[model samples]
Target: MNYWILSIEAIMNTFSIIESKSDIRFKMSLDSTSERGNILDEQSINAGDKILVFIDKPVGEIRYMLEVTGVDHTHLVLHKSYETGYGLTMRKMQQVDEETYNLLESNNHRQLHQISEASFNTLFSHMFEDFSNRYEVKTEQPVIHETKEDYVAPEKNPQDEHLPHNWIVFGAPGTGKSYQIDQQRKTYFGSNYERVTFHPNFSYGQFVGAYKPRPMKEDKSKITYDLVAGPLLRTVTKAMNHPERNYVLIIEEINRANTAAVFGDIFQLLDRNEDGKSEYNIVASEEVKEYIESQTDADLVNYEIHLPSNLYIWATMNTSDQGVFPLDSAFKRRFDFEFISINASEEKIGDIDITIKGIGTMKWNHFRRTLNDYLLQHVRNIKEDKLIGPFFIKKTDLEASDKHFQKVFQNKLLMYLAEDILKTDKTKLFKYPSFSQIVTAYIEDEENVFSDAFTEALAEQE
Candidate 1:
């Protein structure tokens, strides 16, 4: 069977959805199209062909494999207006884990990828075995549930059918919290989205909307202020106007600013109803309500602000960062939290070798794993967040030579340890006349480097 990659913005964006007009992405037309039609004409995908469904935002991740049921000339939902394009009917067949999906780097470059039989068996078989026991598991069970006569079944990815509307991904620094959040919004099909980084002085007006001065077009000297929309306001405006499409609002380092103060009265809209709409609409100022209404397609009712179901709000937090605003029970309870593990990207260090002058060489992954354990074992009342992650020291630092690696150790690694971790009580861990003596001695005179504690830490295995 032929293996192909199919790019989609949403799981159910096919002409299969009733009253759906989003047909451009799923079409396989030849005469009018340029790149996409050329690909489809060459492939000539059949009913038995395999399709690896991928999200369309270039996140380089695949969730499921589906089989092409058939090629439908007419729209799947029975629309007569669209006839030039042909849509494929697909059914989810197999699934893969994120780690397994990340193994191949080729898919990162393109939305479409086709593999030969030999390439599929060599590469895909191993990855599929990591999650599911077999490369292909045949099951004919239908996933649809009948409800009403006019109800139609919408296709969703096997694993991620439902995602939390308000979610936060948290982890220690370098553990890829923001990276995780960035990848997830694509699965939600966030074509229209906004990303804002929070700082100490960020305010409600900046998060929502504010009146800003603008030079008049008629005269350069004259100026009048207008209500300018912020990230949240712009995203909400798009979501309200186009209810069919999904929108996202990303808050990077959310706790850097006071969420309670930044969100203001908008916090009341966090509680969502069964349909994913905000349970309670927060009262808005008359000016603010009028501004939002003018930007939306929906009729104005109570003149209040309510989060649309199509909008998803996500944030990332660094647990290691100091002086961050704390969230109360009420604020924290409103969202689901996902913690990224320190060992998540351990394999990314690969087989990079760092050799100390007086001591034998150790692998990058092995060194960090040993050092992290030593911090927890030897130090008193130490937190996991304080320990360095897999990406704490870049691989390039050790790729050069032993002398260059020693310089990085003395500067970045040792400096972080002295100021943040050990503080004034580093005498027991590091060996030197003073911390300043590290530059003069380059481990040439002794069997072990920095100190006995560090030497012992490096000796650890697994």
Candidate 2:
């Protein structure tokens, strides 16, 4: 029997081993004829090869470390107990040494992950503290996956070519404005996209580039300041370098921040030519110019920076947020605005039951439609803008408990009504003395929150 030993330089090959969240035990059958078994056979996995164990989603994390002990081509089968836990039937088995198995089992699968050995040691030291308490783990091994294929980029949409370089997707709360951008991003840019949410405090320094402090590598006590490019700048630099590929910069809740202030002179770049390039390019600030010159190709640093046609700028805005900074007509005209309307139609997610504790078991779709209809008709000053979208309440949220429902209602819906929608309306539509009274009535099922006037209106529509 030929045993293959891995050299120190062969540690670069990383492999992900799949395991269920309920079970972290490492058990696999190595068959010489099978695809997975072939890799183990080719690599000559021995008792000490290091392998990463990944827990599949719902518990998405690299949860355990495993070492290969004995790799058998035939007659070695996985125990039925371990096979049932992982949802895999093993024809051959690779056993781990007793001590390695015991150490992993005792830890209950605490996550310890790092890209390299040095980083792993640093992290492991802080978490475990005892340097002497090291297990005799194995060397690098080949990944168990059947095949590794490079990703093929999706075809660009012809419609996207005609669309404006800058776009603002505005909608009511939960109207899937950001979701649309995310979908478009995956279609166009694949994984090459940067997303940033614009809060009130978001500034040009944070949006573009800023001189920030960095700890000195030689001495942890010493520090150095470097020009760290923000998401927009970093994406722009990446897009400029890779002109062949499309890049997306997603500005989530764009209206949340002071648009004029956050954008500063860069707002001029929003104006695009007929060909989708920036109509007027702007000179980068001294700090930004210096950073760009050092980081990117010479062509970018030679002249004023322009927003590339291939760089798609997508932004989202919620009309319900009162605190959002208003965009002037000039700024608004720079980008194409796509308005997303509230959709209250039911969505079916299999046969899953969504039962609220006090509200009883009900179809989520029916509940959203009926509630939205009631809000639009009977709630004072409540229009489609103030109405809830179908997706606002997820099936998982509904299944959790009434507490989740109450939290969403009190924090989002009721607060919006009390603070914005019905603030100035003298007519108390629900006939509740206070907002709390309205919430109480709805929670306790003491009163029909909607008036009898809406009953006829609802029947007329039906």
Candidate 3:
């Protein structure tokens, strides 16, 4: 039986056809379909006839071997190999007589078609423009580069689908744990975060919203409730106004305070599921209410509270505190705990220096080599906790005219690490001088070609 060309959709009606090739050599009209019209460009085409199929949805040209099972004035039945035949499938087809077949078969058809001059040129202009567009279109792909400066914010790619209500960051004093908190606050909370360092005697009322008693007439005149909104309540109020922003409440040295005692009723807010804005009242059982009421002459029945969605907490701790108790398992599970490891100087020292220096020089690549050399020798020491943060040497605040930078290194950075570096026995470990002394040498090391004039200015300031 002669092969016929049929669409895959024609498989409902059974008929077999020769294998069809998919490569199209001729320009095919892509607008036609079996429902609209199935007539090929040429009429009366026989089996083994090289024919083009226009595929419209994706708009592409495909070639197939055509086999005619039957024909009529309005339609023709053809078969293709990949699909089974549809018997007497209706389609508009053009007849390809022997002479017309010869004209298409010979390569000279191009020369003859080209002679159609304006008509052929117009057709090709549109075809080429379409083909060029399709060929030129580009697919998007993600690029990942391995570099020291590749810092991606956690919120930009948070582990959870939603941001955490409370977060705690803990590590050694100089491990840059607080740095992450500051950055996250800047990123998520922008200007809304309120940070406070918790101390041993810090009160629950100080952390949570509390009524501050104002001085009354003769100390017994009247009691006025001064609502002092703590970091938690302040963040809650800030987040309520700025729902788009994630308002962060940062507690530095969280272990310094009695977490359970300090949090008190606000501890209920730490439940991640509560999310701070629930309207329901948590009814305390009568027995518990009666017990609490008996102990404190206060009505302790139902507690009406609303949780805010925008409030988040970040706490930083120093693990060296033996006096501080471990966080309760219930409280710990509600938070995602990420332990910020101490610096691996090899990984951080040189890179941080280069980053700071590049900022100083305004050249992105400047100081890379110098920074790398400094860290290559110091990474092991830092990993062993023998070295303080290397960022101390690369202080960029010296260049800044703002009081903020001056205060950041002093208030935050120095308090955490200056003593650590000064205390390190570098002579016993690396046969080197003290960190500050070496830094002094570097500032005075004008003979060094890489050292900038600004170095001398900073050294003078020291």
Candidate 4:
């Protein structure tokens, strides 16, 4: 709370205050996300300032407003809300009247535009702090059954080719690592990114390509080498076809399988050449070679396998998962590892809850605080790796349609917290109170428990 107060002060200093209201005239648009034409007078706003909008008529709703964070001749980008963080304002453009622009410049509007870089950073520091406190719960959105096709890099030059070939992302559960990859597949993979999971049984032949038995018209079945391209093969082939387009091959649960067994000799191609040509060798295991020789007439009989320089590999693994070990030194050298933690902003979580619950009557903040505190008291002694995921606070979980929230809390969540505390025998919790009862009782008692710590603890046990 103290930090939020300080951030507001820093934000105030980022742009010089517009003291003379009469000197400048500005145009405002509130319903930009929708087709509703809700515009307001420029005189109602101050340059480089923040405001909380209150809808007074038609339908009641509240919106946060930010001044034009940046401006160009065509569009003046405005900050949508504090939820977007202070530095990331929405980009939009409006036709500006020359007379109004001249009047604004002649007045103190010019002074407001002359904000220092240091002041801008100070404002962001505060914004980040506010964002952190509000969003403690983080969950990955469901993967849509859609794929994006296009490969232009928005923030990078067309000719730039310095992107890394191998990268690793580490994060707690529900941190959007998978969701981010799925949603932005086109941006990273040049419009044709492919993904596959790596498991203990996965091998080089299975990942690169494999053949299986196909039944014929007769009773007997004949095995034909089906050169069905795996995700890795598809990604490389796509990259070869479009040099200008980037291509990504995402390996989910990379640590689950032995990298050496799966990648085999192609691991050398992990390094990228400046000209964007991947160097690969025809080094396959004896079994793979024998299989290929047996199918001489197969389409994959004579194939050139080389990872293109434009091909990128993005791998994800949970460090806390069981049987997970550090990567081999050779494997480690090929990747840039990044750690993604759970850092959600409260304002963003609040908005998400509103969308999920499809109701405005519930106080989400209260629910979040209560749920988090319950976990804290019960799970204080657990390891950080075993901490409860914050995403269960979503409004959808509380709704009658899904018992996901209840199952997670009573089963998986309780198991994690049980490692820390036990009113009776901890093992009893795992089997006691059947799944249906657990959910029903939790839903009935979540909002009705007494304030007494003992009473609340007792209620949780049921």
TM-score of each: 0.60, 0.59, 0.39, 0.48
Best of the two (2, 4) by lDDT: 2
The best candidate in terms of lDDT: 1
lDDT string for model 3 (37-61, tens) is: 3334344333343222222111112
Q: C-alpha displacement of 171 in model 3, angstroms? A: 2.2
Q: Per the 3 Å backbone cut-off, how many clashing residue pairs does candidate 2 have? A: 6
Cα lDDT of all candidates, in order?
A: 0.59, 0.53, 0.42, 0.44
For residues 266-315, what per-residue lDDT tens digits would candidate 2 score against the true structure?
Answer: 88888888767789988665556666666677455454888887787889
Q: Indicate whether candidate 3 or candidate 4 has the larger TM-score.
A: 4
- Give per-residue CA lDDT, model 1, range 305-375, as digits (tens): 89998777889987667768888889999998998887777776777887665667778778777777777
Model 4, 11-122: lDDT tens digits are 1212111111112223333332212212222432233544332221121111123444443332334443322211211110012223322322243211222223443334
Choose 1 or 4, whichever is better by lDDT: 1
Instruction: In candidate 1, list every pair of residues with a backbone clash.
Output: none
TM-score of candidate 4 versus the correct structure, residues matched by position: 0.48
Candidate 1: deviation at residue 379, Å? 1.8
Where model 3 places Cα greater than 4 Å from the true spot, the runs are 1-161, 213-225, 240-245, 274-302, 321-325, 344-387, 392-462
Q: TM-score of model 3 relative to the true fold?
A: 0.39
Worst 10 residues of 1 by lDDT: 77-86
Better of 1 and 4 by TM-score: 1
